[model samples]
Target: MTGTTDTRPVHDGHHTVGELVNQAGEQLSQLVRQELALAKEELTEKGRRAGRGGGMLGGAGAFAYAGLLGLAGTGVAALSLVLPLWAAALIVTAVLFAIAAVLAVTGRSQLRRATPPTPEVTIGSVKADVEEIRERAHR
Candidate 1:
């Protein structure tokens, strides 16, 4: 027989077992880091959107308070004189209420979009990575 010695089972040429293990470890580490970064980015975006939505809601509350004050003014004007002044106050109050309604609707929509705040894209990517790793392991 030739003087060559073969101890390892068949493998793809060139890379030894230790090299393959090390490469796999490095790749796994990189994948984990990337996934964490993606999750952080996704959460940060969601938080910003949520903050904007909350701010709009707070503005709605302020407008609603202003509408209440206008309504109080309407009552005072109505008691003072039956015509003109109270009507104008009523109109202003209606306008303030309308603005509040619009702000509430827009804020609610923004909040809905931000709900279920999870790193969905990162989750899907990680799931796909797990499946790929499983397939490769089986092979």
Candidate 2:
């Protein structure tokens, strides 16, 4: 077998300068289409993940609210069992209001700590892909 392969340029119908330019343009168009499709898929996946995260957070908030209400009800019932009607009612209302305020603060803290749906990974990936394509095109 020969060590060096044939180096002669083969003419496969697209031999003219215009034809070569047209071919390159077509390939570039295809590359853009494929990249757009990939971006769409990535965005769709990211959107779904964000939606699920939001739903889970909402469910957690609802559960916490229910728990706070239950605790407040228990406190009112226990106090009413031993004290005068009006005094017990006042005390229970005060305790329940305090509990509610605490829960509100806690909920606000949780929300503040929650991670935002920034699509960081997806955007980074797309930026890398765009840079790569730009480099390849320049070459």
User: Which numbered prediction scores highest in TM-score against the true structure?
Assistant: 1
In model 1, pairs of residues that clash are none
Error of model 2, residue 109, in angstroms: 10
Q: For candidate 1, lDDT tens digit of each residue in 1-139?
A: 8899888777657888798999999999999999999999999998999899999999997998798887767665765575577676666667778978998999899998875767999999999999999999999
Assess each prediction's global lDDT (C-alpha) against the native: 0.86, 0.79
lDDT of 2 by residue, 52-132 (tens): 999999999899889977876777677788986677768878877897899899999999999865546556766886798
- Each model's Cα RMSD: 7.4, 7.4
Candidate no. 2 TM-score? 0.53
Q: What TM-score goes with each of the models?
A: 0.60, 0.53
**Candidate 1 runs further than 4 Å off:** 1-13, 72-116
The candidate that achieves the highest lDDT relative to the unseen native structure: 1
